[model samples]
Target: MSQTVSDFIVQRLHQWGVRHIFGYPGDGINGVFGAMNRAQGKEGEIGFVQARHEEMAAFMASAYAKFSGQLGVCIATSGPGASHLITGLYDALLDHQPVLAIVGQQARNALGGHYQQEIDLLSMFKDVAGAYVMQASSPAQVRHLIDRAVRIALARRAPTVIILPNDLQEEPYESPPRAHGTLHSGIGYSAPSIMPREADLDRAAEVLNAGKKVAMLVGAGALGATDEVIAVADRLSAGCAKALLGKAALPDDLPWVTGSIGLLGTEPSYNMMMECDTLLMVGSAFPYAEFLPKEGAARGVQIDIDAGMMSIRFPMEVGLVGDAAETLRALLPRLKPKSDGAWRQSIEADVATWWKTLDGRAHQPAAPVNPQLVAWELSPRLPDRAIITSDSGSCANWFARDLKMRRGMTASLSGGLASMGAAVPYALAAKYAHPDRPVIALVGDGAMQMNNMAELITAAKYWRSWRDPRFVVCVFNNEDLNQVTWEQRIINGDPKFEASQRIPDVSYSRFAELIGLRGIFVDTPQLLGSAWEQALASEMPVVLEVKTDPEVPPLPPHITLQQAKNFSLALLKGDPNESGMIKGAARQVLETILPGKQ
Candidate 1:
């Protein structure tokens, strides 16, 4: 073939530094796959990762962008394959990860007749595509559409979609200025440094400085700006609380920093939100308005790159529209250090006490295993550069609270979408992005069996690609949808329904072995460390299955009377896991009500 549209697409992707494309091959996308095969040389090589499912491909792509800070790319065929990508695409879109999705459509001639594998991809992708959603009508539109899609994804930091009809993929570029000019080179762009106006910064600083007790909420938009955020926090004497997505933005070891906010929150964060006189929201649009101070309870200064996100979460006295780091830098100079350290010290004391309480809870022995202790063991053992991904469930609660993130370590989950089955793909993408760094996936048993457990094979297939393979899958084999079970008992006021939340017991370690990867099974607390060591030593992907107690509830830092009432009802209804629920309630009461006395 003499330089088809498919060839140009691959070539442009290479130029833009997209080293990998995650997707499954299908008949509708055969033309693109064929062109991908023909591309050669160092720059021409865009690794096409063959995921078992299109959903997994989309997740891998989303995580690739998240970990590497690059534009992640995924492709799929028309109809079902394309539809399968929606959830993952939504995950990326809602979480604000830069992703480019290319979906194959039926040939132009058969598009409207509802041919086999035919779907109007543009219509299907409209909602999740963020802004750039277009079809490559002809070969001439291919390069332009691809360029715009990439630009939109990068500049907007959201997903963009390009629908390629099967016939369009094979069409030759005939209307370009020149063949080589059309398939351009040296295409690069830089994000403009966004800083708030001087007056806005001064006003924000004034509002921040005026308050006696300040609390700052940070998010992923403040990534790599840890110093600026901390500087502002220090200047304002603010207790900082990270939104779940910004869990790794600040080291958990920081005395002034509270790990996370909302339901999966720390006592310090909860108390700080309730007590703050001023709130400075740095790049976080944390959706839980209920977790924030009541309107007019605190004066707020909100800073965000997107003007739309500022002041949306909380009532703002000063809304600074700019980049988080830049705005913070400007505000820091204008802010005066607080005279009273008592407010900061009080929050610090609460944080210290909370940790001690958590340590007591995590280490306490259980029948199968203590889930919190498992996370604690893994946290200290993780390499400084380890990239951790957790499935959304009770596993997230453990990982969020117990997993102590350091300066270099990074962790993420489906924060915005709160979806499961993403941990495996996220880990794979992190490994693909930085093969030298250790990548670990913390998944609950419920999430492990969801749809794409087959993607573990993808990790096995690509094991040798890494020079030092240190990918480990830590499965919390509690044999139930523990998070949802807890939710059912506490939120919905129902006894544990075995059929809905209970999971069939699976030997995840054996499954790993069967898939041609190393497996480490841990049923006892004592074996956890050894299993982790063995996993780290293995030069291939290792799945460490930790059989934990399904009964041990993943309790929140603060418990409400409503939650307690629901649990009591469940216990009265002869809930099989009654002991755990009772114990969880007792612990919450002891921790919250009897803090220092306990």
Candidate 2:
């Protein structure tokens, strides 16, 4: 029997080292599904992970690339299935992750006939897969399309697409003939050793050495260069701050390593940025300019692999385009050690006080439970090498500020897209990538209701296959879209419009129990610690739900005068929960000024 085009495409992907493909099944791509079925149980055959929705599948693929540092692949049928993947692909594109999307298209006979499920996929995918997008017209074209899509996605660190017509997928495979207009492509790609010129490194070092106070900001690009970042910081006696996506790049145990920097940032980080005389940004594109040093107030140096991203956030005296670790290694020798230790001492003191303030606030009383306490207690109990993920909302604020990361642990969320419904999928992909380690996801009720609940079924389907059975999804049940509610008060000066902010309260724990997973519900403050213990020790996957007070403010590290006025204006306009809001905000504020007294 002749091998089909789908068979050859699968074989080609395997040669390029694709281990798994995440997506849902559809008739439009039935040929590929048949190919995957036939190839199963063979050596080095790719595995298929079935997701509840195409969107979640795409999110899983994006996250798999992020956690495993490999090329992630996702597949779907024609039309709606293809459209659903756009959000997840954009997540990978904005975060600069390498991913390839393979989708089915209408049969060749139906082209331009406006047949059912015959949308123009190329036009739809052009923006997200702008690096590369192609359709296979003949069996000979499938090989190069697969080869180039994988190569380009990896080389450019962005998503690429290849559309296969249903009729073509079933046709007999053919290789391109050795003639003009025919091309042959091969497998394999390796990142080049990139480092800045010696002259550039010398200039960056000079800028650092001349300043008495130096500050460093690290992002996801610095994840692999942890040791190098530490060495540079020690030599310059600088305090290092991490962007949200780079939380695990430096351990919070280090005295001078301030926590997340930005709206969900730390006090020490805000102070360091405001006071430093020189700044060094490594592999981070943290978008907020207000959180950085004032213009012309500090000399700047930046290092990034992408030349386009270099020096865009802040004006730099020197911009070095290279891999983070290699560039920092080259720059280390030229840096002269700072003899005066005063600046380092001050930064350390501030970091220490900030932690104390956080502890005091966590211990303050709430209507039922303080959300900050949930994260703070989990910080000390997290197992070594555990992987954590969080959804975007008020819970992320706590995840950023309270959870102290240790060395050897990994964590990530929807960094660039900041999309909801990604936490559960991210955790699922993380578990598949590293089955030996435990994975936890911190999600808010809003995101849980959005689409994460259905993903719990995906977890139930695959948990037994994992070597370690400890996968916990902790849900903050606050009954409100707390982040946007607070944003209304602080950013828009509008009251909490109850209709939009309030969400229906569902028993997330009970739903877990119905699906054969352990469920633990906590409403009292005293039960929070033990609930986590019970869930982590369970033999099966668990959902730990905590009833938290929505009125508790997710206060920024530093509040501006305008923000203060806006908050006051919202209160004057009669917010629905005005009394509880006042009390929660006061208790948190008082804890900072009068520690342990609240």
Candidate 3:
């Protein structure tokens, strides 16, 4: 008996434990899709999601991969469809995620006489993959290339590309079976670094013996090390605060976990990151150079697995290259918990004052509706089990700063590259990953519309979706790339604010309705309760679109002289029109953070 290459690929993917494939069918790829259709949903596994764009398919699959801790799969025809996968693949690479991209070729016979949709995939993807292999040129090549590609993807925990030809789609293929191979799971952690072990604990102990005004800037790597992180903070009589991504690694309500850092970071974190005399970096490599206090402003120690990252962003007196959990555990027992809590009251008072000031600045009184106000109101209302995701913009800063976290919650985002289109697909994948937990996306108007919201179809089509109908999207529809516009004002020195910054005024409610998802569009807070309540009730996907004042300028996370001037200029841009008002409000918000006052 024999089967086509397409059939063999699907069968092997199944054996590889891939239960879903995200992609759009194309000319040369029809055979592959048909083959997958034949083998799907059997033995409690394997299915497909037909995405509107190859890009979205890749995104959704990438999210699924990240959430499940398994390799994600995507299929595309050669040329343009294959090209569409680059962005998502790049995202996976940055996150160190695993993905297998299987592309359909023109056919074995059509080897580059400029055949339609032809691509030198080897050349095109060499930079992006751990491995790239085209259709088995020879019979002996198939087993090796396929096995090698799968191995590389798992080993590198990045992308592996396998290009199959149309003619080989069903080439009579047979090979003797080998022993069941090890999966190579490829997931491993480096041992905790322990150098000057006695002194490191002694140094931390010295700070604890001396005072209580110590704090931590915990990062993503701090996850699962919660007990040790908290205990170390306790030993030093220091409290803990997290980076935006570090939100999940620790609980939000804990007295020590003070929230994120830098601009759009929580007021408590801002006050503490600056106020603490000794700062400890637990598993995070925070990159915002401007946000850190002057060198030696606060004596610091950083712990990380990658030696290079020990103190790359900011200098540290003691750098430990190791796992956060192991390092923290070893440092304990030897370190003493302080008897009298020095500086805790002072730090607490300052933290309280900082949050009080931010409270007024974060929310507003007047109308046309502020985007900040919308995000502020919604963040509190979300469920305890929410897996929140955000798009980069003014809203991202707001979400990172204000969104409350519970132990059950998880948040994901595209770091610094700040891509706009990932919100919805991430939400879908979070739903797939957690299923029972609520998944919400807090997106700006420009970001929410990315990928054209077609992921709603994928959401609706899933046979078993996340419960609580909690995979809802609350979009801050301000209708402009406000961050870019803000940059134009602060750095570019543009004068009068312009309405042209608003690219489009698409009716989001209408679009959500078109997709059969519940759509709630609002202009007033009076409608928020019902809109929110009903949206949460939806059995399928829900889109709560709130029209916001486009001119609402986001406030800085914390303030400095340079920030004061930039915000002042942004205020200067505000005219009587919408953009002006936003600038004005932004400037007003900055005024509250005037130095010495905080």
Question: Residue 1, candidate 1: how far off, in angstroms?
Answer: 4.5
| Regions more than 4 Å wrong, model 1 | 177-186, 587-598
TM-score of each: 0.96, 0.99, 0.86
Of 1 and 3, the candidate ranking higher by TM-score:
1
Identify the leading candidate in terms of TM-score. Answer: 2
For residues 338-358, could you state the per-residue lDDT of candidate 3 as single tens digits?
776755555556556655554
Off by over 4 Å in 3: 130-155, 176-213, 317-319, 463-468, 495-500, 566-579, 582-598
Query: How do these models rank on TM-score, best leading?
Result: 2, 1, 3
Error of 1 at 282 (Å): 1.0
**Candidate 2 vs candidate 3: which has greater TM-score?**
2
Q: In model 1, what lDDT does residue 334 have?
A: 90
Look at candidate 1 and give me any clashing residue pairs.
none
Can you give the lDDT of residue 370 in candidate 1?
83
TM-score for predicted model 1 compared with the true structure: 0.96
**How would you encode candidate 1's per-residue C-alpha lDDT over 1-598 as one tens digit per residue?**
5888888888888888888999988888878898889885545988889898999999999999989999999999988999999999999998888899988889998878969987778888999995899987777767678778898899998999988888888888554556564654236668899888888888887888799999989998888789998888888888999988888889988888877888887778989999999998887868999789989899998888888887788879888888888788777789998999999999899889878777777766576798887888887788888899999988888887878889988888887898899999998899888888989999998888985368899998998988669889989998889888989888877889988988899898999999999889989899888888889778888999999987777776667899889877777788877777676556545655564453
